[model samples]
Target: MSEALLIAVLALPAVGAAAAFFPDRAGRLFGTVLAALAFVASLLLGAYSQPASWFAYTPAAQGAPPIVPWTSVDTPWVPALDLRLHFGVDGVSYPLVVLTTLLTLLCCLYTLWHVPTGGRGSTLVALLLVVEVGMLGTFLALDLVLFFVFFEVVLLPMYAVIAGWGGERRRHAARKFALYTLFGSVLLLVGVFTVVAAAGTADLVTLTSGSVSLTRNTQLAAFALLAIAFAVKSPLWPLHTWLPDAHTQAPTVGSVLLAGVLLKMGTYGLIRVAVGVAPEGARWASPLLGALAVAAILVGCLVCLAQTELKRLIAYSSVGHMGFVLLGVATLTATGIQAALIGNVAHGIITGLLFFLAGAVKDRFHTGDLAVLGGLRERSPWLSGLLAFAAIASLGLPGLAGFWGEAFAVVAAFERGGAGWVTLGVLAAIGGALTAAYFLRMLRKVTHGAASPAVAAPPLPALRVSGMELVAWSPLVVLALLVGLVPAVVLGLSAAPVQSLVEAVTP
Candidate 1:
């Protein structure tokens, strides 16, 4: 385990994306096979890779640590500006990297089974592989400039996926999504430069692992820039307007990955970049962040109650679920950060399942409007049951993956109360209750009652759940239950890393 494994993990997908330009049949096969290969390579990297420095300039001061060496590939690219081509994974980012690969693999499988209308399967699969590379790179990049490059790499492919292969208003949604995220990327770039300039280095590990420090003003300014950038990506509260449109218009695979992996990048950035590099700033701004988190929770639930479209409803639900994760970050404590990490993974699994089910329902009944769809249980009990199960999981039902993150977040807030965090905790609890209310409302409207004319219309084939759908969704379902029953699976991985983060803030 050297850099060979990490290089293979990234290169295989890039190669796959390029190969997907072949003839349609061959391209699709190559895409899926290559994505599977990349996923395996990532797993191997997780298991066998050791801390190694691919390239680094020795520091002037004796006994100082190099730019990279902690399960990373580090190579000098711009010594004058202190930039490096660096990639690494620690406990905090490892699970997310794995989740990205897993979800991309599943999306490829789903694409093979049911290619979305209005696009070539090969193109969609190729774009998905590219997105995987960007996501994995974001999670693993150990230098701020390198991280920003990977972060921006995801933008174009996702925009094309939406605009080229989406529903009505696709272009508008794609443009909005692109513009919003691009604006954030600008802020992120500026913030990265500000931090690098202030700290005299661009290595994320060096700055964040507490080797560098900045003045209070620099910390505050940089964190402000970075937080706004991350917030737009997180789509917190008012800034979150782009998410519903994007999710509603995007194709099934697009929606799944958007909700599953893309959104986590924002919250993860808050933890890794904003707090990790600007601890004092994080403490200074924690109150405002906490308030916004509560606002997102409440606002999302209220919107979910009013949403008629299934995908739109699920999209709004993400805002609320992510609020818990953000609140955990705002708490800036180990327990809270662990909750944030678990919540991030749980949201990926549970919301990915919800989006898949929503897509399946839309495909069958040809409508996602709650008023026009009902009695799915009578015709497609399995699909209906899965939808119900996903809804329960989303509602934070006990013994499911969604439960622990939300519960722990509230507990952390209550324990770490100050400057209205207690109020934030109470409001979050209400959001959780509202989460149940709207989910139950959705189930009642779409899963129960008399079959509306659309559902009962004659000549409609009784659509059974497809094998590919099961293959894509079953892992999420099982993982949700597994994590719920034994949260240590996720929490255990992030605990040590999050504790380190907590110390950064506390010290």
Candidate 2:
């Protein structure tokens, strides 16, 4: 109800990270205390938000109320460039802020005993809280420069996690991750500057309300720069080469955030920036974006099929899932945008769950190679069952989170047509089949056989799956069912934003 929520949301973790630096094992205790309070505050904010504008596609009463009053905080920061430090959220930002906080807190829980016992554990937890602050700020920022600053803040901690605490090729993977992302950030800065210079203001609320259009040539160029930046984060094909290595090297909590909230930043930016500000450019670039989307789906699926490593396979599959989100955006319709929006949330939860479980399995077995791990069902029925369930959901099994986004995107594609859209849709459908093939194969290989030697973990007093693990996984499983059964839980709140975006971009 007040800006205090925003300040507290960002500050709680910073306080925890600072407190963790004490000479004792206070990092874990500080993280727990602060994480719990931050999560609770976020929840209270969600429950206390005001009502939003209505969308006819959804019943008026169904959407989530604003997570706080639709309040904007602004003060002169870089007055030389007419930039102000501004931040606010409407319906769109509400859910994602809650998501970032929710997952950060959950990731904190998962790390309590789950982090690598001896090596850089405190630093990992502290960095994670910093990552949370960055994600929260990115979603809530109302100024382009502010958004960019917060967005970049996320890079350091993530790079450190992968490079410092990752697997065998941590340095190489971290360097590649930094290079690819830094390039994108450069382009993103160029685009942000272009918008500020051309439009005379960088406040998102004002920019959305202002009907200023860049020249078609300018629009196309700027959109290309901006879109590519987002795509790299989205890890859309070609630009996605760095993701597998990064994911493979990252710790479990790192992978969860990467697959979950971090990747969504790109797709979110494309809709919020490119289409929202440069509708003409979006229309002109539709065919190109569509082609890239379908291509990414096919290429990602193929990679998934060929991967022998479990984490690498899951990372590739994200490339495929995100392709579906991009494909939806290319259609430039309410349904398409809605599909992208809701699908992003679904993919985040389900895939985040998979990575979390994958890390658990790897900890138990000391490996993530499919050929080495097997019959997890026999060894740990609970873990095996959850893995199978997540795999099914990933493959778009009905009555689950995965089905809504893919199905809706396919429908959106079917409903729209222009410049080879038909072909794009056809290829995407085939990609969908490939998705099924890879996930099914993964299930067969990892959970179906007798417990293999690779699955044998260190003989440290049989690590019982603790109550805390249940506390972490139970929400994911319930959320999978909740969203699967009642997707309106998300789709409803997102409808207004989706419609607003489509109307802005439509011819």
The TM-score, computed over Cα atoms with residue i paired to residue i, of candidate 2 is 0.94
Q: Write the per-residue lDDT of candidate 2 for residues 276-385, one digit (tens) a residue.
A: 76778889888888889899899999989999999999999999999999999988987888888878988989999999888888888888999888877776778888
C-alpha local distance difference test of each model: 0.87, 0.81
List TM-scores for all candidates, in order.
Answer: 0.95, 0.94
Cα lDDT of model 1 by residue, 1-507, tens digit: 747888888889899997557887678888999999988987788667523231222222333322233377888888776678888876678789889988999998898888887778898899999999999888888888988999999999999999998999999999999999999999999999899888988888789867787999999999999999999998787799999999999999999999999999999999998998999999999888888898999999999999988899999999998889999999988778889999999999999999999999888878899999998877778999999999999899999999988998998899896748888999999999999999999999887977778877634454787787899899999998998898876765555567567766885
Whole-model lDDT for model 2 versus the true structure?
A: 0.81
Runs in model 1 lying further than 4 Å from the true structure: 50-70, 458-462
lDDT of 1: 0.87
Clash count list over all predictions: 0, 1
Model 1 poorest 10 in a row by lDDT = 52-61
What is the lDDT for 447 in model 1? 79
- The prediction achieving the highest lDDT against the true structure is 1
Which consecutive 10 residues in model 2 have the weakest lDDT in total? 60-69
